[model samples]
Target: MTTARDTILARLGSPDGDPAAEHAALRRDYLHEHHPDVDLVELFAERLADYQAVVHLVPEGELPRALSRALWEGGYVIPDGVPEEWVSGIEPSRRAGADTDLTAVAGVITGCAAAIAETGTIVLDHGPGQGRRALTLVPDHHLVVVTADRISADVPGALALLDATRPLTFVSGPSATSDIELSRVEGVHGPRTLEVFLT
Candidate 1:
């Protein structure tokens, strides 16, 4: 019995009969980063802002105050693995976990594994401080904390720093999509508002 998947696979069989070798033989000539001379932090900020995210450049010493002020409304969740000092003075409404009630929180605060400046994308590996997939997706707002050192010049540069085995989430901007009529909608798949604090 030929299943639908089997039929599809049979029709799309490897053309060269050696996909691995064929891929390895392909020419590869590409720049890893386009603007080597540009400051990654500034470039990342610019690109992030272009994506309609509220970007804040805060000093390390002032991050607590900034975080407190930004999350003053008090309905945010904090995930595990966030540095103690980072949220030392602020209190989150919920602590993210498997049983966390996503509907109760207005937003979530998290840390990213790496950020790509050229693409204005934040990559999350669901590591400590970064919660499970639902924590960021279900909330209406997401406040991401990014350090200057974590900023990469391009996607390749960022990919080099990430572990391939971990589940990864690449957030370019707030959830948005346009239909056939060209009507744009925001917050359709993820947070409607994205705010980033860069230190």
Candidate 2:
């Protein structure tokens, strides 16, 4: 009997073949065939919003102010780590980073590691520069900032750039669930609202 590893290897075709070249060619063919006219970022935004996520576009220089305004409008108390420059126009109460309870927060604004356009997914790895995972997960609303350069065309391309060792969260849209009756409900497991800001 063939071992599982041997079976998998056989199923993947001959080992003598250039795996990288074969995979690249396959990806190219698949994308051209199925996603010929896709404007990756636009498609991603459309899908995200279709899933009830609010999408916003802002200039790079205006990012901080936009974030502050979004937070204020969403009724969140600002945390200290959030730059004062960003919160300049907003009138929300300010608290130290340690003082803010995530559950009580109406929204949390964060920078994403990257976004995969084909699947309309945003990736978050809790790196020190990116902020804590709890900040994004515990809040009712998540406002993610994704620069144009950080957007990828599809899952395969996105995965190629991601670090496998890190704890990663992939979000396609808002948290949702379906009841036994087949009724669909939103905001069950995570953020009820997922807002994406593309710069």
Candidate 3:
């Protein structure tokens, strides 16, 4: 009567053992082996920019202005529902959500829920502050704001911090593809350009 799952479990060890303790031990070992001593936010910014992504740094009070500047430089007009206070000090064109066209937009700016330093990835859970999936995927360029406190050292670190119940988007670099002939192309599925702002 033993099922495949039961067979595997029996072969491995008793399922009655403390799963939480095993998980903690694994996490500790992983962190000790792979965690870097460098500042994650700064390291992530450097790596992202090195991969051809525009990099910026901003404080809490200066985020609005910085975002505005990035949008303007990228040739996008701000939307109406997007608060002026959310992006102040820069004058970009504004369009309605329905009217907004991806082909016309130079870029989209949003916040990231968490950033993984080991893999140089950003995780978005579609939170209110992070905006919708289309905002990052449709535009040719994406400007993501990542706070130092939210940056993690690796994938497991990031997963431990994120909620599984929410929608998650993980971006490592700009969208890219390769042809059968081995010719590489960028911006195939998502933003061709990725810019990171570490604060």
Could you report the Cα RMSD, in angstroms, for every candidate shown? Answer: 5.3, 4.9, 4.4
TM-score to native of every candidate shown: 0.82, 0.73, 0.74
In order of lDDT, best first, we have 1, 3, 2
Model 2 residue 145 CA deviation (Å) reads 0.5
lDDT tens readout by residue for model 1, 1-199: 8899988876556675677776576666888889899999999999998899999999988888887787634367788888878877675333444466887777888999999999999999999989888898998989999998889999889998899899999998888899999998999999999999999
What TM-score would candidate 1 get against the native?
Answer: 0.82
Identify the runs in model 1 with alpha carbons over 4 angstroms from their true place: 1-28, 72-74, 92-98
lDDT of 3 by residue, 112-145 (tens): 7788887788999877566777777888878777
The worst-scoring run of ten residues by lDDT in candidate 3 lies at 72-81
Q: Which pairs clash in the backbone of model 2?
A: none
Model 3 stretches with alpha carbons more than 4 Å out: 1-6, 9-29, 72-86, 90-104
Q: Tens digits of per-residue lDDT for model 2 on 1-199?
A: 8899998887677969987777766534445224657777787788788788889878767877777666634355343344455446555453325347777667766667778887789998766334676776677878777878878787767776688789898988998889899898887778888878888
